[model samples]
Target: MSDLYEKLKRFQQNTPVQKPSPPALVPSSSTSKPLPDQLLKIPGIVRGSQVMEKIQQRDDAKKKFLSTLGVNEVTNPAGKYGYREIKISNRELPITKEDIGGLEIQTISRDASLAVFNANDFLFFDTETTGLAGGTGTTPFLIGIGFFDEDGFRVCQYMMRDYDEEAAVLHDLVKQIGRFPALASYNGKCFDAPILQARFLLNRLRFPITDMPHLDLLFAARRFWKKMLPSCSLSTVESRILGRTREEDISGELIPYVYFDFLRGIRIERMRPVLFHNVEDVVSLAMLAAKICRMVRHPENECRHGWEWFGLGCCLAAAGMWERTFFCLEQAVLEPSLSLEEWIAINKFLSLSYKRLARMKEAVDVWQRMIERGEDVFAMIELAKFHEHTEKKYAEALALTERAILQMRNRQNDVMANGPATVMYEELLHRWNRLLEKRKNP
Candidate 1:
């Protein structure tokens, strides 16, 4: 055994052992194919499944989606595109022209550059898009419009079946919008109309929504309710102004995901809530339009809150409806919730409205209230003018002028007094001289 072991060791020591070669650490760029190219060719690098699986047929998916919606699918004569459309009765929406006076639309839209748009020509429009950050890639899947007809208010929704079907939907929308002279939307001027116009340009279709006047209720709602609501979203406006709350509505942010799922052969049940959300949006558009028109028409009507009265007064003043402005201001002042600043502003407007109507007594009363509250130099000047010129009471005018001069002195060091104090100071001096002259002459 010792001789065998010695021979094996000698043989192993004499034998030459060859070393294995290490792999060549070549750089990735050494390959002719790029990594991204290789990755693209891979079936599914991460998912372990086929990448870019066959997409569902556009027409078939559309049919299935429409079937779930219980809406009719329409194809143009050219058969190049197809869309879905539905018309529901006013029962679905209880708003009528009577609910919003026909004349009131004319008044409310007067300053909105809709001079020619009448109730017959006003179209309430809303859109449901695949994304809120709208651009060329974002598509409006649904366009819902409402207008008054023999059936009261009829809402017609035109929905796209697929990306290719947008042309048909836009064509139908243009035809419907052509009948109306103006479009009323919640935020259409900034959001919906621009998106539709982009879609039309992308499709190489003529965008019929010309320079036509668009009444964006968003601005109006913000002007009136910004002080009252936490946010001026349509939902908040509907709840606060129209007293309508949406229940079981899908979150707006999830709509795009649900629509993409529908395109990928997911069940249509996911899209039903989205469609219902769109429907409510359209119906609420009409109702909100009517509600705003009613508010404009009846500025003197009791408002739900003090801020509403103040907002109405401002609107009336802008429209040159002095009597109505005065009425709204009077109502606003009676509200207990009015802040000191708002109360002063309302009284100032109220005094101006009264003076515009030659109702000097009412104007004087408003100024007296301002003087009692904290003392408004402008109000004091107006009261002094009334006493001196209208009542021919120089003594009373002198007293008011002297009081305003003293108040101006008190506010001289106050930083709040900008140009207003200078103007009031000059007016007070002019009034004092005039009162002295009147006393001497009388």
Candidate 2:
């Protein structure tokens, strides 16, 4: 053991120790900071100066665009971002109070009181949004409100130059919308109002339009023009109902792209058409509201076609005004332009309206007219019921029931072509048996 230990110690002492290799030699130039241009070449590295230059460019573009439109900057004391506003005088618009006067608000808004509010008491509003894909991400970049004052009609538009300015826009809209008692829009109840509410919630602000009486003209317009017009869009109503066609209006789908280009400091001039489109939309909204109000107030004088009378009758029927429904429907059936389908529909409603008002004679006359026009099973059934129960004419009731059964069988054959044909046949057979027993007993 001692000899083995001596040998190991001699081995350790004779071994030579090697020194550590020197560190890699970096060039002196590599130690210095890189130049701005050279650093920019590296991926994922943006120069601070370039960022500031782009921001300055965007600011300059915003200023130039706003200045050209005579927009005034609005400073909010409670918010960091500010918005821009521009007012259009009454002379610039093509509407007057006389055009929109005499509206019965209850006709359009069933909850509203009749004759309490007029055209001046309502505020007409519209919005231009970033996209139709409604969500938190979709923003309303522009808002337009039109109202009547002692002088005349005036339109106020609020615009945000950047996304940060949205809070300020909502802040000011709350104030502006508070002055009006009621609201009117083309489709505000579904689209604009909800979007505004969402924006208000996101901005931590109170929505002023909430709980305000809102009259969405889309419903009324559909009631009046659904059959007459190809579409009930605001643009179609403007051209067809209001007789105003836009010559240079920008397409709505292109508006968001234009706004994005403006934000990126590219072709700021394209925004001009978007602004024009918005202004025209607000103005057209006012005009269309006027037309709709006038039509509801004096449908006899305001309505130009039979379909309008039919629509008015339907509206009145929904409102539970049976007497007015009867009158409008009576007039609707007189026009020769009505198609066979429209004629049959109008007569059906007319008969029901008469029944609601207890004008049985008129109702019977309408049913008779429907029978004369076509083989109407509904009219035959109604007449059979009336004859059997009210007039005590069992023979006539049996005859009408037989006619209705035949009509139903023919319709089923025409439609389904060969089957047991149970469409209304059992009902008719039961009525026939009951009528036969009543006839024999009488």
C-alpha lDDT score of every prediction, in listed order: 0.77, 0.80
Candidate 2 wrong stretches, greater than 4 Å = 1-46, 78-95, 98-103, 113-115, 318-323, 413-423
How high is the lDDT of residue 429 in model 1?
87
RMSD of each: 12.6, 6.9
**lDDT by residue for model 2 (1-442), tens:** 9999999999999999989999999787786666876888776576666888889988877777777876667778545332434455568666667766533557655654434677788888998899976777888998888888876667788888888888878877888888888888888998999898899998888888788888888888898889889999888888888888787788888888988888888888887777778778877877777776677778888888788898888877777877777778888889888888889988998888788778899999999989998878889999988999999999999999999887886677553653444646777898899888888898
Predicted candidate 1 versus true structure: per-residue lDDT over 1-442, tens digit per residue: 9999999999999999999999989886684776776776765663443333334354466576577666677777423333434565667655666655445554555554675455567788888889999888889987888888766666777777667778777777778889987788888988899898998898788888868777778877876788889999998888878898777688888888888877766765677787778778877877777777778765545367777887777776777777777777888888888788878887887888889889888999999999999688778888988888889999998999999999888878762457766776887888799889989998
TM-score against truth, every candidate: 0.73, 0.84
Cα miss at 384, model 2 (Å)?
A: 1.0
